[model samples]
Target: MSISVPQLHAELPTGCSVDRSGFMRRVSGVQAVSPISPPRSPVPLRLSVPGRLLAGGIGLGCLVILMIAGLVVPDSRGVGTHEQLGMPACGFLSRTGIPCGTCGMTTSFSLLVRGDLPAAFRAQPFGAVAGVAAGMTVWAAGYIAITGRPVHRLFRRCSATWLVGILLGAWLISWGWKIFVVVGGLVGG
Candidate 1:
């Protein structure tokens, strides 16, 4: 719980300065390979009771979603698996004759939970990626809830802009991939 921060005038390493945020930042104009500045030391994650409860709830919610996806039979057409849940057909796809961004996401999740990785990716690459992300979230949340220990705490350095930019880029690229698959008649599309 005790931290010893060097005084601002102290002889620290070149280009590194302890900022007001208590993180060692590179103040010099020397261009680093990555914009993200890692913390001087790994910070420990200790969640409060409310935080643990929230994590448990989120993990359970994701689990239920995955379970429901697994229960549904994946459409051979590579989409419309949600229709099995009494959901209506995709309005966007029905109108344009093009698969929507989330057209095969449900099918992909279903396939993934059913242990058909290849088919899941074929159904929708983004769907598979989302499934993996959700699965990881579930695991991390469960670990946090049960153990109240640090899990990948050092990863908090990346800025919100960077994280959102990466996810958005992936989503757009995956949408383009879906278009390619549909246009090329790769699947039932």
Candidate 2:
């Protein structure tokens, strides 16, 4: 079978003629035919102002919790505030005598909230990053909540797989750094 497209004829002056070529494509026993491209869907619509405000409000609430936890709890000097909060100690540390990935996170965040950057990093680099991220989120979310304007669209175009991979990679790197810090401390002190 073959498909054909209609030809167009236009009137022109003498000796000025338009040449017409047959527009047909053979469709018999095609070995390698290019697949038809699917129509692209539009970007999903973003949340409205009030909807964004609601989301931001929830984020701000989480930030508030982090802030309150930071303020009310004191840094345990890498021991973490989990015990102070009536939580069990790190099981890995208790059994294997090695710090876990999140062992000093609470202490790191608390120290960071107290404006001790070096101490925070020494406590847990990832926790310091988490504290900073929480603060930034609080600020951005508050702005979105109050003004109803979308803040930076940095990750608007990021795919879920990319985002998850980035996050996991960061987590792994941070965990490795945490282990290195802990081992260095043990060796130095």
Candidate 3:
């Protein structure tokens, strides 16, 4: 027996049926297939330039306030008033009565605020450098927000090794100086 191609294409099992156009119409009296819609792409999230500027401005403003407070608030008696204000002195060395890497930072900051560069260095050479570096960082961020351009590229290009070396050298020099002072006092006594 020869079956026509259209008949074969349209043919369905018992309890199923096909339309006259040689396509399966239904199975068990139900539609054979349902059409599906294509999936939609996700919408991208974006911040407007004005919104970015506002956020940047707020952040920079907060930083400026902090810098001003740090410089202006006097705590020269060696008793930390900033500590009560939630500013923690270095924990690693303060507990031991030994000068930590950042021991003279407050004194240095005080000297810097007073415009005494030599006194600042005498207090803690690295602290003045750190203060300037931090100020420059804030300035750069504000500059980028305002002008959409980097103010300085040296920090971006500087290597991690250079930073580590500077920090280590500063710490060792400060530690050595403290030791020398202690030794000199013992010898004099």
CA lDDT, every prediction? 0.82, 0.69, 0.56
lDDT of 3 by residue, 1-189 (tens): 222236565335544555565555445555456458877546433345775586477558647644664655544432243464577875754576555666556655655666776655655567666656555556665656666543335567878899799788977886565445333432210
Candidate number with the higher lDDT (1 or 2): 1
Candidate 3 lands at a TM-score of: 0.50
lDDT of 1 by residue, 51-148 (tens): 88988998899989899998999988888999999999989878887888888899999999988888888888889989988898899889989987
Stretches of candidate 2 off by over 4 Å are 1-50, 72-76, 157-159, 183-189
Model 3 clashes, total count: 0
Pick the winner on lDDT between candidates 1 and 3.
1
Ranking by TM-score: 1, 2, 3
lDDT score, residue 55, model 2? 63
- Which run of 10 residues does model 2 get worst, by summed lDDT? 9-18
What residue pairs clash in candidate 2, if any at all? none
Error of 1 at 143 (Å): 0.6
Q: Report backbone clashes per prediction.
A: 0, 0, 0
Better of 1 and 3 by TM-score: 1
Q: Model 2, 1-189: lDDT tens per residue?
A: 333445543423233333345445444454554569998756534568778868687777868767765765654447557688778988987787667878778887777888988877777777778888888888878766666666656777989899789877877777777677666664211
Q: What does the lDDT read for residue 72 in candidate 3? A: 51
Candidate 2 residue-wise lDDT at 85: 76
RMSD of each: 10.4, 9.8, 15.3
